[model samples]
Target chain A: MSDTRTSAGVDNFAVSKKMFTWQVEGERSITILTAGNLATTQSLISLLDERSVSGEERDPSILHQPTMFQVARLVGATLREIIIGASETGQTSADQFGASIIVGGQIKGGKPTVFLVYPEGNFIEITEDTPYFQIGETKYGKPIIVRAYDPKMDFADAIKLLLVSFDSTVKSNLSVGLPFDLQIYETDSFTSDRSKRIQADDPIYQAIATGWGDALRDAFQKLPSYKV
Target chain B: MSDTRTSAGVDNFAVSKKMFTWQVEGERSITILTAGNLATTQSLISLLDERSVSGEERDPSILHQPTMFQVARLVGATLREIIIGASETGQTSADQFGASIIVGGQIKGGKPTVFLVYPEGNFIEITEDTPYFQIGETKYGKPIIVRAYDPKMDFADAIKLLLVSFDSTVKSNLSVGLPFDLQIYETDSFTSDRSKRIQADDPIYQAIATGWGDALRDAFQKLPSYKV
Candidate 1:
């Protein structure tokens, strides 16, 4: 094994090599692809923290204050604490020496955002046109997110969508087993009550688990198969 | 955040939860799924060291021998050592804390396996028809494995699928970045030489990345939109 260290610091939000493509109402909107590295996070935070010449950190005089790095730091710190606690208690195990966190939401006056947080206390926010967030072993669950996500989705819909996403991940990755803790807050509601921990045997989640697996198999069967 | 320390050990020829899953052909083939706290790495080593009916400790025998817990210890030790090294290099600032390992594979003549290695150096394997493995922010990348995994898949195909799976994960989770280290060995290959470090800018990977994202969007657009 190569001696590569898998630690994310404040400055190292490595953008995924993958490009994110989306089409809305027959129009294509492709943002320049970038990973959530420390530089990107810092730049974003700086833009968000910029006040019109006053130098006041939290200046309200500006019409739009961006989400600062401090905000990212605060969010990263919260997630770090959560994962640390989880690891200590044996709820979640780290792989190759790291945990994963997805922290996304709109800051006041900013566009709705999404970010994927590394175990090293760093983050990357998703942009508006592509408004969704995913963490853990996510590929098994990504198709659903791509198929179902909508910018106008209400918090309820978003939470359900996220649950489905989590369900897909759990089914595919045993390391990411439940009970899952989900929290969904409205854009402006800083404090919300839409958080729930869905256990492995939770009824609603069970329905989703069985329903989705069956639906996927059925869909696969319906698709054209390759000729031998 | 609940405190629950669950541990399991695989004895001589004994498989742990690290490598259990159901394989899908016309039916599901379950792999490993042993459960118990005392069944951990230390206990398994002790069990292996025990004398046979001849009152003499058996030599290291691969036949009917249990998978080694030393593998988990190695992975954990590697992670901890890397974290320490990174901290000394100023690449990590999080005080000597955080990290985990997911170690799993098959022992010769034993069932193929999987395990989630904790920071404390214990592990559990997966046994069942689910003949695959994953580590890191695995939640985001698991769906593809569930939908597309076939136990009889050629090693090439399986590795490709895993690459794509990892692609989805790196895209969705910041903690699991690349250049990714991937290794694929046939059941009997004593050494894993198929291993390669995947960087973000690799051309073929770039193609898969763009293709997957585009395919997802195309499929999404074709889906019937909900009438909210």
Candidate 2:
């Protein structure tokens, strides 16, 4: 899942998709959620798409990577290349071109997996103990996920959990806003049909946003008050 | 209320009080919560205390500031003095000597009030619409406060709300930890007996920490799941 709100400054924001998905029928699927310099992220994604379509016959692309880890590596390498290239031009420091990515999905023989790729081109796979990754204004939304996460949660519950988290973040932070883009990739199923964009006026999103606040207040009230 | 955990670096944490309080017999009371470079904050508080004790009889001290805003101004001036003094010495930049403070309580003839003093010696008072201020590690703990704050809440519930906020922060960030110091000042009462240090093993704190997690999970389960 990714939020569509892209910000250039505290007072400047626009709706833009930050998620890119590539799938080849039932053979393979990959999804990337990006957060960072919009220019760098867009260029990196375009490079990946262009390479997958026009790479030298012997020079394999992300679609040709055998495992999820290789796919993450390819993404990271491409990001590092863009940043390094920008730095070499003397226009901006490498830091200004920094970007982070969360790459997930299944490819042929490998099971569904997720990896967090840092700006420096290194990556870490998500484990059962730490099942999710978030970037760009994360702290306000973290406590809920830390408290409520369960690996056994079904897709419905997982999406609910994320929306609640995003609602909390959006309420507390101005930079992150509504119209969240959501995609649910089922294990071993290389399909892209379960994706949807949650607009600000979406009834279900509104209900969850309003309902979670009331539910939290109700829960807070049930906790024993501190004694004087 | 102030959390006692202080950090010099991510791995270097120690128990240190960050809250200072002053009160006069049935006449006035004041409290200051600080967060920043420990040396700067400590020195700033020390200056406040020293000046209050040794200033010329007619010079007037924080105890004689007449209003919470003046006290805030006094605190901010003291902080600026310390930072400016250090900057003048050429030992560190002004930013390195920066600190922030939250000053709250009642002075004689003044209603209970709170002011946030920035390092540059400016301040803002909290109003009915924005009833609270947090100085450090704010974002991880902000959502709960934003959702649950109420001016009409009794002191006990207010303390419960704060503990829950602190608990959420301590759980999510390593730089913040247990053993919180709490002080409750009643309006116009001018007494300071209602203070306690919440130790790591304190049963009530333990219960709130454990119970809040369970309560949050319960609340999460109660939220309506998103339909696919």
What is the DockQ score of candidate 1, to 2 decimals?
0.12
For candidate 1, write residues A1-228 as lDDT tens digits: 000111254344322222221112221111112222333333333443343345575654122234534445654564455445545756545332344434444455454445666766787766667655544344666767765677886555555566667666555544344555554444555433444555668766566566555554443333322111
In model 2, the Cα lDDT at residue A225 comes to 84
For candidate 2, write residues B35-133 as lDDT tens digits: 988988999878778778886675558988878888888888888888888889887679987889999889778899899999898999997788889
* Top-TM-score structure, candidate number: 2
Off by over 4 Å in 2: A57-60, A87-93, B56-60, B84-96
Residue A207 error, candidate 1, Å: 13
> How far in Å is the alpha carbon of B216 misplaced in model 1?
2.2
Docking class of 2: medium
Model 2, position A208: C-alpha lDDT score = 88
What fraction of the genuine interface contacts, i.e. the true contacts, does candidate 2 reproduce?
Answer: 0.76
RMSD (CA, Å), candidate 2 to true, equals: 2.4
